[model samples]
Each structure stands twice: as C-alpha cells, then as structure tokens.
Target: MMHGRDDALDALRISDAEAQAVLRELDSVQPALPGGDGRRHRRYAYYVPGGVGLQIQGVSQTYLVRPRNISRGGIAFLHGLYLYKGTPCTLVLKTRGGERLLARGVVQQCRCVRGRIHEVRVRFVEEVDVELFVDTFAQAGDAESGPGYDGGQMLDVLDKLRDAVEDGASLDEVRKSVARLARMVAPRAPAQP
Candidate 1:
C-alpha cells in the first residue's frame, strides 16, 4: 500500500476535503520545498555516520537505515528498500549523545545511485528535537569520565578548533575546548600557577 502526500497531510488532523482543497491551492502556486529554499530547510554539509530507524506508513515493521546527512527540515539516508516519494514515514535517530529523536516525515526523493543502494530524502512533517541533531556533531559524557572525550578524528577536532578561531568563537568557548583536549591528551603535570 502506498501512502501519498494526502496521507501525510492527513496526519495533520485535517479533513480529507480540506486536504484536497489545500492540495489544490498548492497546485496553483509554484511549489516551494518545505523549510524554505524551494526545498526544505537550508541543507548543511553535516555528515553524521549513524543508524536511523525508518518506518513507512502501512508497513508493519521498522527498518534500520544509515543517515548520510541532515538538515533542520529533513534527513537524507541510504537504504536498501525503495520508498515512493510522498510516502509518510517515521524517523528515529539514535544520536551519539545517546538521545533518541523521533520525527514524522514524507519522502521527497528516492534516487537509486547504483544497483541496490537507494538514497532517500525525507522532509519532516513536524518539529524535530534539535538536541539530537546537535549531538551528531558532539558526543555525550560517560559515567566513568563524566563527559565523554571527543570521539571524532584528531584532524577533525583540529579543523574545528581552527574554524573556531576563524569564525570568531568566544575566547571562553575556545578555552573550554582546549581544556577538554588538554585533559584527554596530557599526563598528570604540575598545576598551572
């Protein structure tokens, strides 16, 4: 069974007739992608390698998918299954910070890059938990060490530190970042005077 844009709109708690009317109105106008920019929220080069839980409406079970990138308005992921555009779906992201984020969305694009690999784009239907998205760039603390140390590659961390200086990150933020790094890399030394 294929659920289309109508099904997605239906999730908004609107009557079928009203949904049709809205669709008609939308049809009359140049369709701008949700989240603006003629296509969902501003897309960022956020490459967070993590698992995403995907559930297509009418599908009884959930699928584990790998996300390639994310934006405020949507997420793009790679999956083996093909989901038709406009299909209403649920996305559950397990952040590196150990937070689980759930969002309702509709498939916008499903492109087959190679044979069995499908790149799926989903536009969120409602507000998504921002903390989870932010967590993709940072890690949560562990019980042993309180806040966990940086899990990203050292080069990546250095790039961020360089970017902070270039982007005018507050001195306090830089100090904190440096302090965290120092704590992880250095052995017990004399305390700073």
Candidate 2:
C-alpha cells in the first residue's frame, strides 16, 4: 500500500521548471482585482457545485468542481483531481441563489499540501459578478429546501427572464419577477438610515 501511494505521488508531481513556467504565465495574464476582503470580511465558506469548461487552443474540456471557499478575489476548489497548474479555463458557477456567474482564470498553483487531497488556486483574469453570486447563494441556503437547490430550476428562471425580455415584456415586469424570486428564496435585510 505504501509503495502504491508513493507511485501515485510521483505521478502527480510537476517538475520545478513546469511550476515556474505556470507561475510566469499566470502572473502575465492575471488581472488587477482587490484580494477578497483585506480585514473584516477575510474569508467565507461556501459549498457550491459548478462546471468549468476549458477551450484551450480549440481543445474543449470540462471539469466538475465544488467550490469550497470563495472571496471577491478568487475561489479555491477542495480537490484538483484532474486540474493542473497553468490550466486556462472558464469557470461557470451556478450558485444556489439562482445566479450564473462566469469568470476567466488560470490555474496559478495546485498541490497536495496536506493529507492526500489537492488544493487548486485560480487567479481571476476578468471581472466577476461577486455581489449577485454571493447574495443569491445566501438566499438559496435560507430557502426551505436548504442548500441543495436545483441547478435546472435556476437555469429555467434565466431562460424565462430571457424570453420575457425578448418577447417584449416590460422591463418593470422583469424587474418585479426578479425581485419576487429573490425574496422568495431569501429575504433581504432592512436598510439602514
């Protein structure tokens, strides 16, 4: 068993040169964004499952990931089983709150730092709808159904919104529906003076 484990480790290891190249590429493409919350809102734990589609040089690939922790800056996946450093991919997260947030990022680093699981770090390369994603997911969690909100339901809502706008439904109607859905999933806090 020990020998098998050693073999697996060796297979997963990346050479130093490869690591450096990956870091260099990431630095060159990473965008300028505030790194999460500097002080008070340091970090937040969120469990959201999503799909990451990679279209690298026309070779398309997709990976399933469950975001373990997310901040304004970036997201960390619990395990990088099939992901590697330097992997450029588009992350599409279907938050529990019925919002689909898209982000362009490259895998900056990944390693099995502790235990046998790997931690994958991605650096954002474009603007992300952090507010909508965060708010929606928070609302979904508070729903009676709990955190296991259906992704299909969210997609259906988006399709309806699109159809409503395309079919010439008034903007006010769309807005009201969106607000109603949000409130149904999660009630908003009272405004401060």
lDDT of each: 0.57, 0.49
Clashes of each: 4, 1
Model 1 clash number: 4
Could you estimate the TM-score for every candidate? Answer: 0.48, 0.43
Candidate 2 TM-score, C-alpha based: 0.43
lDDT of 1 by residue, 1-193 (tens): 3222222221123333443444344335522222234543433333333345777888756776656556667877666677899899987766647555678899999977455556688888874533346542233333444433334333445666789999999999789667656654544333356
List candidate 1 stretches off by more than 4 Å.
1-40, 45-50, 129-131, 135-193
Q: What does candidate 2's lDDT look like per residue over 81-108, in tens digits?
A: 6466788766665555765556777787
- Residue pairs in collision within model 1: 33-38, 34-40, 141-147, 141-148
Which whole-number lDDT from 0 to 100 does residue 16 have in model 2? 41
Q: Once model 1 is optimally superposed onto the true structure by TM-score, how far is the C-alpha of residue 182 displaced, in angstroms?
A: 22
